[model samples]
Target chain A: MCGIVGLFLKKDDLRPQLGDMLTDMLITMTDRGPDSAGIAIYGPETEGMVKITVQSDSPETAFAHLDAALCAAIDAPVTIKVIDTHAVLTVPEASEAAAIAWLEETGLRIMGSGASMEIYKEVGLPKDVAARFGLREMGGSHGIGHTRMATESAVTTMGAHPFSTADDQCLVHNGSLSNHNQMRRTLARKGVFTRSENDTEVGAAYISSRIAEGATLGEALEGTIKDLDGFFTFVTGTRNGFGVVRDPIACKPAVMAETEDYVAFASEYRAFADLPGIEAARVWEPEPATVYFWER
Target chain B: MTTTLDMTATDLRAVNTTLQAAARAQANEDYEIINPRGAHAMACGLDGPLTVTIKGSTGYYCAGMNKEATVTVEGSAGPGVAENMMSGIVTIEGDASQYAGATGHGGLLNIKGNASSRCGISMKGIDIVVHGNIGHMSAFMAQKGNLVVLGDAGDALGDSLYEARLFVRGSVKSLGADCIEKEMRPEHLEILAKLLEQAGADAKPEEFKRYGSARKLYNFNIDHADEY
Candidate 1:
């Protein structure tokens, strides 16, 4: 099991200082997920072709080689960088789907891609990852963080989440995708490149691609909800705002506490027990198959 | 003296106020409570040397989160009694609902009657005594607790049990995953006797049988998960 926390509010909304509160929420849930942590802040640049992650052990060299290939293949400049263990790339003019297919043809797996979000993750305790990326200081109107305990995938930075693309779509998840391999095949036929072995990233890419192609985040999530099998509390943040929903069967635990100040969700009540104003607040479980969303 | 708190005073704050008044009335002395009508979470979130008694049935989470307090319910209780409790005594004079004694870090729970499903789930370091039968899935996922049932137990007893010892006197409906019936020793009988005596159950320990985990699911082995 993993723990996920996200705060959503309208732009320039008046809310109290919650830096320490958010950290405390994450810290309280360390027992649920002890592997890795990552968070992404969505801001101004919300356009352009998405950079898809391709997993090659030689991330730096693989990204460099793939950059040259994309440049030669699409006749457009490709921007690349070796961020920690994973490499991120942005193609100036080519469609993200086309770039993903081109990269897959070269046998490199696409890790993640989006134009609206920047994602950073690594393997370790939450504090270790927080210290690495300085998560304490990162702030946004809405942001999501994940502490993963690598069940189906290796305990690596790649498995850590709030998987983002060059576009503005980012997602963090708690629970498994039992039918991920089958869904990955379906996405592959549509030229969606998936890099990480973690099924969460695959689900993120699928939903984000749908939203990028004119589907609302809620609609894309609704489409994926029927397609996605097994227990999951899927939470996604788009440029419009942030939305959280759960799968049909209520197999995993997800509790919610929302106020005009902000909305937050976690795998347990104890995680959100210390949130500001949660005392005397209404706390309830996210019912199975229900779409209770908060957007501003 | 015993007093009556009617059903309308069922809210937590109301119950807290009454309990405080009761505490003051019985200051520096032993006390008892009677005729609390359908109040959920009665005497919950309290810590004291005070002894509380509830005479009738209850709703969810009765006597939850007690500390150093001795609570006695003469009738049936709802779910989650003594949940996450630390250092106390909660004796149910009748049957109890699911999740009884859940996550109890310390204390003793004496159920003079039967216990419903999921009893002692996730229990930690508490001593539980059940004089009568217990329902299905009792003690499921229990950790570091001692559950003693002088009578029978229902299906799936001690499912996913972790370091918790269960002693049942009669037939088990079925053993749960990773749980096994063990040979009862003289030392275990002594322990059961002491627990029964504490609960005023006065049952014979020789009639009881012990159950516990087989220790297979401790480390999260992928291959062995199918067995779970």
Candidate 2:
């Protein structure tokens, strides 16, 4: 079993509390998935700059002098902020591809790259991972967190969820996909590749490929219900939208609550018990094979 | 007197142990649980007469295996609420998650709001009344009892059923294998009326249609062996 929690703030005032709220929500779901935890926060954005989140086993050595070296190599200004094993490198938007290539050549694993999103994940308990990243102090407009129990792959750092395959687009899943191996081959033939052996990463790559082919976020999520087999309750995020969808046979539990201020999704109601104004939110379970999306 | 147990202050095991002891001793007391916060398995395994009112929502398996105890959740419930219940009544003021009242033996499970998939699956002699719609694969392999729905039923309702009576006031998307629409006889109406009254449902019994097993797949004939 896995736990997924997503929060989309409709009001600008709640942006500062997004990380704190999401941290509590993710920790409450510790029992649902204790193998690993991850979070993707869509924080403040800078014009003409892109953020590339990368993780290294030895951040002290790998990150040292990395920004200066990348700046000189790409001939563009690069600033890296290290948080635990992960670092967010902000580079010129025009030089993102070059920066990513150079960073990849350095053997650093790219977690995600986007205009505003920063992804952090590790193999540990949810509370420990949250503490390691100081997740409670961060702020964002929206975010998605995942606690994984590792059904389809090993419990490694790469297996942790909030798998991001495209810029500012990520997905966290609660159920196992039965046809991921077959689907992985189909995507590979289309020039789309996944980094990890995790089934959820394949799901993420599939969504990213669909979006790259000019599908909307809602349409890409709807395609999952038709193409992907087995049970799944997926919560996906983009630059300006958050989407949710469940498979036809929705054995995996999902509960959503929407107030005037925010839209929240979780694998269970317990994850939402402490949200602000939750006592009066319009809470309901998303129907099977239906795509529900909220856009800014 | 109504004893209050605050879950935020006392742990879940201690609270459940207190309620279980009350049931075993037949304390016949009223207990109010506060700050449930969607905790799983709240007030389970009771065997005697008692009254439990959970102030907020609960997690999985709430009021499971109940006997002679009337447990009420003032808010919603998670999965497997009242599962395997033996007797007495369990009520939910709000919606219930998947597999509500699954494999229950006896007593009444009244969900005032919607119930997700697999409601009353493999139920044996239990009576469940859902005021709102139920999801797919409900009452699959149900043995005996009554499932009354005041609203619509999702796809594949009552698949592979066995003797359980299903009454729906609204539309049914589809019926499962070995399940078909059955005539509403006077005896069936009698059962429906009693359950509706006990569940505090306002729907009239005459507005419903009954469904049950066709009994074709029960015996496994050689002609249908390839289909299986």
Candidate 3:
């Protein structure tokens, strides 16, 4: 079991409160799944620049001289911002692939790579995880958070959610996949490698592979109902949009609220009670097997 | 005595504790619960004839296992509202999510708006009345009681039903196995009339068609194997 929370702001004024609102939303679901938690935030982006968020067990050594090493290897200017155990690196857009490759060879794990998105996750109570990363002060256009209770995999940071393998794409899941091992092998054969043994990571890779092959977000999500077998409610975020889908059975609980200012998705209605102007929001459950997406 | 509890500050446990104390003392008190904010398991295990009115929406399993209180939700309800209730009156002013009144043994559950799928599954003597439409598979495997749907009934109504009387004023998409349209005798019409009056519904009893178990597969008969 897990808790998934997502917010896509339609109004720019609410961006400053994105982290604060998301933090409140995630913590409300602490009773749902309290093992581990993670979040992915999509913030402002610069022209022709990409950001790569990475996590290290020992940040003092893993991050030291990392910017200089990457800048020298890729022959491009790279800047890094360290927040606790995670670091966000900004580099020339063209060198993103090369920089990622260079970092991987140096035995560093890349959490996420996108034009504006940065992912931070760890194994702990959601409240502690959020406090460790100072998540309440960060702001973004759209964000997704997950609190996980391990079912198929061991409880570890690598098993936590917001698994992103492609640029500008990440997904958090609330249910288990019945056929993930088969699909994982299928994705691996197509050259999409998921770094963790978590089933949710395989789900994320499947969507990324589909989008990489030029399928629209809706089409890719629809494909999940046919190709993947499981009870799942997936909330995915891209550079410009947020998407939600439930399996045909829709066994997991998911509620969505949309207003003039923003669209929110949560595993339960309590997560939405604290949002600003929520009493007037159009609250309802998304239909089973249907893809609901919103873009800025 | 009548009291008011503000859930936004007092939390759910305090409200429950106060109600439990009132019930233990047999004080037929009236309570006003404000700002429930979609919390689960509110007003559960009520065993006294008290009046508890919730001012806002509630999350899952609200009013579950109620014994004798009269509970009312001023707003919508999440899944399993009034589930496993042995006795009482639970009313919803707005729509209800899935499994409303599920596995109830004895109670009167009334929903002013639509109810989602599995409205009264496995019911055992509860009287459920939905003013609006109900989703698929309602009254599945019900052992006994009455289900009155004033609006339309979705697919597979009363599947595997056993002795439960279902009255639908609107169309039924399909009937479940062992469930079939039955003759609405005067006794059934009288039951429906009483149910409508108890629920404060406006629909006429004559507009509804009664449904129940066919009893064709109630016992093991090789001749009915094909039907099974």
Model 3 deviation from the true structure expressed as Cα RMSD, one decimal place: 2.3
Error of 3 at A34 (Å): 1.0
The total number of steric clashes, by the backbone 3 Å criterion, in model 2 comes to: 0
Cα error, residue A208 of model 2, in Å, equals 0.9
Order of models, best lDDT first: 2, 3, 1
**Which 10 consecutive residues of model 3 chain B have the lowest summed lDDT?**
B19-28
Question: TM-score winner among the candidates?
Answer: 2
**Alpha carbon lDDT at B54, candidate 2:** 99
> How does residue A175 of candidate 1 score in lDDT?
90
Runs in model 1 lying further than 4 Å from the true structure: A11-21, A46-115, A164-166, A209-215, B1-228
lDDT of 3 by residue, B116-191 (tens): 7888999999999999988778999998999999999987899999988999999998898999999999999998
Docking class of 3: medium
Per-residue CA lDDT of candidate 1, range B91-150, in tens?
887667667898888899988777766778888888888887776777888888699987
Q: Score the docking of each candidate (DockQ).
A: 0.04, 0.82, 0.58
How many clashes (backbone N, Cα, C below 3 Å) per candidate? 15, 0, 0
Candidate 1's residue-wise lDDT over A60-159, tens digit each? 5666676787878877777776655555677753467677778878766444555545565667787776665555564556667788877878887667
